[model samples]
Target: MNTEQPLKERLKQILNQNGHALSFEEREILLHELIDLHGQAKEGKNNETEQIRQAFLHNLCHVPQSLTHETFSRFFAENIKPADFRALEWEMPEQYFQITEALYLLRSHIETEKVFDYVTELLVHALRSFERNGEYKKMIELLQLVPVPPSAMNQELLSLRAQAHIHETRRVQHFRQLLYKYLFLQALLIFVAFPILFVKAENGAIAKTIEEATDVEMTEERVQYLSYADGLYWSIITAASIGYGDITPVTNIGRIIAAILGSMGVITIGIIAGLILDRITPRNF
Candidate 1:
């Protein structure tokens, strides 16, 4: 049985509901209606295009799926006139325009088995739109959809793919750098807190124990006990939640500060791990 015939009939029912020829605007509207209907019936609503160009793609998707690959190849190859496209370019929304241009490329590729100048132009435009919109993932997917044309166009495709990759890498690095900055700030907080707590602490057993362990002198007066370098080293150990027991605080305020630093260390570690996993994870194209 011909699946396309039934699908075309469904589309015609939608298009002919008003009993009019397909106007440019009505074509767009009816296409959206079809997409919504199709989503309800067949595919899920997980696609970004479902969010961005819900009406056009849904209807366009049906057109391609209705026919066999060969039929689709031939249909576009024979029917899309350059003059018609030139005219459509002036009127169609950019989302529609990009899809149409991609169709044209597919059609041309089917006929000649090589890349055309038009395909190059279409890719460049698509890349710019995707990059501007922060759609690096979409760009990666689109690049894959783009059939490798001739040897000349292969390089262009590779270059665009590389550009998308570079953008993604930079984004991951930025996130990692941000995580590192937070960790540094938290460590600095611990560094500053250690000395202050040491000075404020009474000359109790805990103070004397820390002094002996760290090989430093803790005075009852509000004076520095540990050097700045030692303070920072101790801060790192505390932030790591290691609790080496060599420089523990006996005062209530010191214990409270230690608790806060431990919590912060856990959160910072979690964020850094998540970011690293995101960078390493394979993205679905």
Candidate 2:
């Protein structure tokens, strides 16, 4: 019996039957009217009125087959005001996503160059959101979606894309450099410590070639000097996984150190290889 019920049903029927017949301007006007009606009906929790508003909004957002670039530009200018695209305090509004989606749909229907400024502005706005949230990866992915802009157009898009890649590459490179330094320092420390450990081993840590060659053990001084030299050489070769067999570890402690050095060598080499590949490989995006 309610008048609002009949009005809501009538609006829904009009949208369902004659929606495509209406021009964008007329549809936009209807959408605004439905929004007001929906607000009033919200107090009464009228689901039917909400459905009608949504239907009208859906129709408004879509581009018609007969739509022309000029009419689209005019309608876009009038209905999609610049003020509506302004950044919100917390999150972007639903309208922002809707407008972007509409713009994407309009790409086939209209010359994007005509709306280049608006498209760029929207992209910048979206990027600012990601930047504020520290979502660099998402920013890169979003930039990838856009085709490379022609040089004749504003260079802002190209600049933004380049800057994002540069920033990401620098960040990755900094981390890799830090990791490389840490590994190098660790290897250096182990190299320095090897002689000390070898000198203290109860049994000679390395093969006693000088003692064995003469069939008379070398003097303590000679043994000590050779121990230091052998320790330095062995550490380098073992850590590099290039055991030349000219120097070798004989004791348990020496073998344990060899294992550790070998593992570290593999890891270090992997990191270096990754760095080289990253430098040489062309990034797809």
Candidate 3:
């Protein structure tokens, strides 16, 4: 029975059932409806759209289920892209715009195969967009309708490119934030804390430790000792076993710090090493 069916006949039936097709009149109706929905969502009335979207999503989540939102699975490949749910971009709430953009980029990628290159493009696009002091808020509108020629293959490719770019940029930003936090914490260890913590140095450290003529110089110095950064770095270096010889603690209490940091270094290294074994490990990129 399936083999006897025409491809367009089967697809048309499926799309119609999934609410994908739009006659010119239907497109007009959707345009106005989307504008209204956008306004309502902005006014915090997305309960209706949320309900509609969720119902379709949940139904497809069943074991014997759909291949798209209401039809095929999201990952299904086809010649032309399925019309995006957020086809009416301007009609969406501002907060929903980014997510809508993300989905569009994703769907576009499904239609096109240039996933990695598209993502790199988005990163650069975001950077240049920011540098130009370009209009950030309305830029999303420009994004959705990036003028694919009427050809099905070209449309599919551009959509995919746009989607890949968005996904990569978002992932990169999230990763960048983690790195920034790591660096900030690292800087705190290097510049702010190591200078103050000291224990009477023995061996090569003794001459330099004695020469400082200072340790815990003021009230700020006293407060810094209580901070976690003090122990964290000591632990990091000790754990890495890099005893860099430069940043070790000097004062009596500082030497006491070395003991704690040294022990911490051991535990931290084990944790970092174990993290590498997981399946969805944090991307270093």
Candidate 4:
């Protein structure tokens, strides 16, 4: 409840403007009660502003009950931490959602006072926390619900929105770059290294003999020692770090090449995993 007489008068005027018609006696009774409660509000109570807002909310049919200043003070003392704004328990999703909606409501209607400015600051804090959590899209979505403030605050919100977009874009680009690198390496193994290895193996002689007998190519024909499709499959599976061992190199040189490829695969996969974690993890608030 607001103790200031002028603010009480302003509230009366605002109520009348919103189509509430209170008799003179009724208005006097309500204003005096609020003033008395405001007088009783203790020192060091953190939720006096919230109590006043709740009074307005009750009259506006937004809340089930209007909280007294003392009740609000006690509630917050028990439930809220003075440090970071996290609730002790996040199990009640609907309660959190309702609080967000209530804040939006307050932002839209409340006059630009200290209380309203504090609400705006809380919204900004929430935005920063969401950004740190890597919930960029969610942060943007929540920001959209906030009514535009004065030019300066609105610009600040817009800047935060832009920052979220830039980070998301960078994340996407990093993923695409990693993907391209992996695919290029896979292609090199399939198209260049695999063909050379296949042609040098003893299997190449047998395959060449079969090709000549079948007249698939002339005696001068270049033999394809391994199936190109099989080589591609092996490249994909090996890079994925899932060697099923169905098809393997038979020669010593081929085994050495496989060892090198397996090592490269391990290092590349580790790098990719680290990049993904970096993208998802939240930065400092």
Predicted model with the maximum TM-score: 2
TM-score (all chains, Cα) for each model: 0.45, 0.50, 0.29, 0.37
lDDT of 3 by residue, 206-241 (tens): 435445666533222221223345445444565468
Error of 4 at 2 (Å): 29
What are the root-mean-square deviations of the candidates from the true structure over C-alphas? 12.8, 11.9, 16.4, 15.8
Q: Where does candidate 4 clash, by residue pair?
A: none
Model 3 misplaced regions, further than 4 Å? 1-61, 65-157, 187-192, 200-239, 242-252, 263-285
Backbone clashes, each candidate: 1, 0, 19, 0
lDDT for 103 (candidate 4): 41
Task: Please give the lDDT score for candidate 4.
Answer: 0.51
Assess each prediction's global lDDT (C-alpha) against the native: 0.53, 0.57, 0.40, 0.51
Error of 3 at 60 (Å): 5.3
Residue 178 lDDT (model 4)? 72
lDDT (Cα, tens digit) per residue for candidate 4, span 212-271:
789785234233346656666665566567468986766544456567667777777787
At residue 133, candidate 3 shows an lDDT of: 49
> By descending lDDT, how would the candidates be arranged?
2, 1, 4, 3
Question: What would the per-residue lDDT of candidate 2 be over residues 246-277, giving only the tens digit for each residue?
Answer: 76555655567667777877787887788667
User: What lDDT, from 0 to 1, does candidate 3 have?
Assistant: 0.40
